[model samples]
Target: MNSISSRTFWVSLAVAFGVTLYVTSSVLAPFLIGVAIAYMLDPLCERLDRIGVPRWAAAGAVLFGFFSTLTAVSYFLIPFVWGQLVDLVKHLPEIRTALMSYLQPALDAGKPHISPMVIERVQEIANISTGTIVSGANKIVKGAVTGGLAVMDVSVIFVLSPIVGFYLLKDWPELSSFITDSLPRAYEKKILALARAIDQTLAAWLRGQMVLCLVLACFYMVALTLSGLKFSLLIGLLTGLCAFIPFVGFAIGLTAALVAAAFSFDTWTGWACVGFIFAIGQMLESYVLTPRLIGQSVGLHEVWVMFALMAGGAVLGFTGVLLAVPTAAILRVLLKSAYGSYLESDYYTK
Candidate 1:
């Protein structure tokens, strides 16, 4: 195909794929999740195979470790997190009361400087916002539980993901080779090179992000618990999970921790401790952990990543989010290659 035609064909194919994924999102979530899991674990499976383990055995081991970890989290951690959520919901009124008590004095002091109309409007808005927030929060929590249960009852994600992951991991080599073989002979080398680049980029990001999440979770959990914060475990784990989304995780975690501290601790010292804990965590992540673990040269920019995540979530919900990074990585590789080719062509050289 001519270059323009080729580009058009690929773009059309991508759009079609995206539309199909969106249409079948409800059913595709499990399969997509399984594919992601398998992709991440395939390297380890290959490593084990290299070290004389059978592919099936390696796949099984990975699955076993995964499920064992899941079991532990489900038994020990989930209950505590659930309790904290329920407690937070129950105490929303108290939280609002305390917040208002703290802010009211300032409002009163500024009354002389501020118009009575403005004060009344502010008060009215605050009350409305607080009511909406509390009611919405309560509804969201209940709806989340109901929605999760409904999904589990209807979808095969819980049951099928592991099975799919296991088979994909086991057959990874053959599957990969088949893809390569199916490619046009002239494009094989370039396509394979692009695939390798995409794999390397994704592997580094995903693996590093996972490690970062775990370490941050442990640090936050321990520090907050030691600092005597309420619901520290839940807040800490949640923050860690959010860390994958760049700034969003840190902002959410910090806000949650601060609110909890504001309610639980009577002294300024407790507040200071919470601040110190998060400050140190942020510094460590930005300066040490990320630089060393995630490396300095991930090709995708933060804005691009944030955009991809938002776009994915908007279009495909959870499945889009799962596929976002890899898709971004693939497109980056392809675009870079195309740009390089363009730079070398007569149009650019002239």
Candidate 2:
């Protein structure tokens, strides 16, 4: 094939493959998650192997350590989160009353002609109760019925992941060699350079973001609790995790904290303290945590990040959002390199 024909063929094939993957994404979710886990663990496994551990032994050790850590976190954190959610649900009525009391004056002052219908709708939504005990009991029963199947699925992935990861990691070098050897002779070097650049960018993003989330979560919990906020741990951990979704963490965390402050303490002093706590947290995150951990060089603007997240969510639900930023970053680097090459070419200069 001529260069143009070859490029067209490859692009068409890529589009077809992407469409096929999208169509089958639900079934592939577990495998995708497993691959991500494997990717993260591969480095640790390699380090162990370099220190004289056998590949199988290293993989086993890494998997065991991963599960053990997960179990410990679940044991401690799950209950705390669950309790907070339960309490929050239980207090919904009171919270609604407090919210109305807080907002009634503002609404009256801002819009004298506000319809009662609108106010009623808002009040109805706010008064929505989760009825924790009854709801919890029903959920438990439903969960028990569904849990068996979920467990089976988890077990299958758990079993398959390490095996797949082991072979993938073990054959990683050979796989790279095979791919490089098979590439078109003319494009081989350029393709390899692009691949390496994409890999490094993704690795930095995934690993760095994970560490940042943990650090932020710890900081949020300590700061909020010291400020005497209710459900500090739950709210903090949630906020940190949601930080992955751009501005979502700040919005949710601040809103929750503000409401809790409104309810828990009646004094303006209490409210001011809550506001100051979040302001301090934001400042620390901006000035210290993010800079120290992830740095500003991920090369994505906040607006672009938000757009990619929304686009991804629209296309592929949660998985798309998860994959979007790294994918965008990699594509951005490739495009920049390609554009630079074009700029240096005779056709572009002319």
Candidate 3:
């Protein structure tokens, strides 16, 4: 083929790929989530295979167990969460009242020093923040359950995701090999080494993060329940699950927990206990769980991960958000390789 024609063909393929993603973005969430599930389960599948389980059977076993647990949770756990959400929404006024009760003493004490304008602004900020927190949560959860788009997405997750995951899990090795084989010969060896490193490290990191989240969730649930938190189960689970989102999850969970604490407790000690639970959770994650599970670094910074997620969601909806981190990690790896080459070149030697 002529060089120009070849260039056109490649460009056309890229355009087609982008167009396809845009067209199918609405339905891509379940499929993308399935892909992630398959990737995460690949190690387990491999382990089962090594112990005399056929690859297909191993894939089936793992996927079945996972989806079964997920289905059970959707059936039983979700309704409980919904109930907590409803109760939380109902208690929002009390949370605000309690918050003001605590704030009023300080406001009165500083009334002469703090202008009325400042006091008004402070009250407005607190009201809006708390109101937005629960209201936003209510809207998102309800929309996911009842929205027209939600039906299709949720159905796909139930019916289609397992099938997608099964095939991907079973074919993982061949798929990896095929990708490596498709690279150009000139730098194939160099790239293959980098690819393998990326594959191992990235996979380990993702799997570790999943484990970390689960561990944190269980810990929070138990700890909060013991502390007599009114919505201990709800707060603990939220805190645990959200642990994966860097600071955002912790912030949402902590804010909710603190509000619940203020409303539920008469004593400052109960309030302090609730605050310490979150403080301990954060410290545990930073000093212990993260270091042991995901190592000290995973190439992608917190800011970059947040940016990628936001940008991806903005561009491609839920599917984009799901893929953003892995895609960013891959690009960072490649860029690092290019940087190394540049340093060795005469251009850099000068």
Candidate 4:
């Protein structure tokens, strides 16, 4: 086939794949999660294999360790989070009273013309209730049911992940060789170089971000706990997790901490402490955690990162969010290549 025809065919194929992906996204979440787990464990499995462990055994060991760690975390963290949530719910009346007291003066001063009935109705609707709790529980149950369905649909992927991982680990070297062998000899070196660059970028980003999250979580927990904040563990864990979403995590965490602190202490001192803790966390993240962990890897702008996250969330919900950064990294590589080609073209020179 002519070059033009080949290009057209590849472009059409890509479009078809994208369409299929979008349509099948609901069932794709588990498979994507499995793939992410496999990808993260692949290096460890390879290292074990290199030291004379069989590929299957290495894969099994890595999978076991991974799941064990997850189980341990869930055991401790889940209950902590649950308790915090229950406590927060139980104290809703006090929180509402505190908020009303804080806001009433401002409302009165700012909007004298506003009707008291309208304000009271707004407050009543906003008030936390048993019905709200029940509604939340119902939503959780519905979500769990849907999640169960998705799990059942993707059961094969979950069951097969370790199996697939074993072979992939064993054959990784051979697979790379096979791909390189199949590529056009003229472009083989270039393709390999590009692949290595992409791999390095992705690996650095993943490992660095994870470490940053953990460190930030610890910092948050210590600071908030010292500040006498209620639900410190839950807030800290959430703040750290959300930290991955750029500023959104810190903002949510700070607001939640401030509210909790205010309710707990009923004074500006608590609010001041809340602010100080977050300021320290932010300072550490900006000056210490990010610089030390991420370094100069994956140079995408914060705006672009935010856009990618939002786009991914819109496209595929949580799974999309998980995949967003890696996908953006790959796109960055492709864009860099295209730009380089354009720069070298005769039309550009003219």
Best by TM-score: 1
Off by over 4 Å in 1: 1-12, 144-155
lDDT of 2 by residue, 272-317 (tens): 8878877877787778877776677766666777788899889998
Whole-model lDDT values for every prediction = 0.87, 0.76, 0.83, 0.78
Measured by lDDT, the strongest candidate is: 1
Task: Return the lDDT, model 1, position 269.
Answer: 95
Query: Distance (Å) between predicted and true CA of 2, model 1?
Result: 6.7
RMSD of each: 2.2, 3.8, 2.9, 3.5
Query: By descending TM-score, how would the candidates be arranged?
Result: 1, 3, 4, 2
Please provide, for model 4 over 1-350, each residue's C-alpha lDDT reduced to its tens digit, 9 standing for 90 to 100. Answer: 78999899889989998899888876676566666677778899779877999877887788888878877988977887777776776676676677667766766675667788877765666555434744675566456447876567567666766566556665666777898898877778888888887788777777788889988988888888888889898899889988888899999899878767768786788888888889988998889888777776677656777889999999888768877988888888878888999999997999
lDDT of 3 by residue, 1-350 (tens): 67899789889998999899889988787788879889889989999989999889999999989978877877976777778767776777777788878877887888799899998888788778767866786787678667987777577687887888999999998998898888767769987888776776677678877888888888887898899887777888888887767898899889878878888889989989988988999999989998888885566677777788889989988789887878777877888889999999999999
Candidate 1 contains a number of clashing pairs equal to 0
> What TM-score, to 2 decimals, does candidate 2 have?
0.84
**lDDT, candidate 1, 209-282, per-residue tens:** 89999899989988999998988998999988888888889999999888788788998899899999989989
- For candidate 1, give the lDDT: 0.87
* Residue pairs whose backbone atoms clash in candidate 4: none
Q: Which stretches of candidate 2 lie over 4 Å from their true place?
A: 110-167
Model 1 residue 124 lDDT score: 85
TM-score of each model, in listed order: 0.92, 0.84, 0.87, 0.85
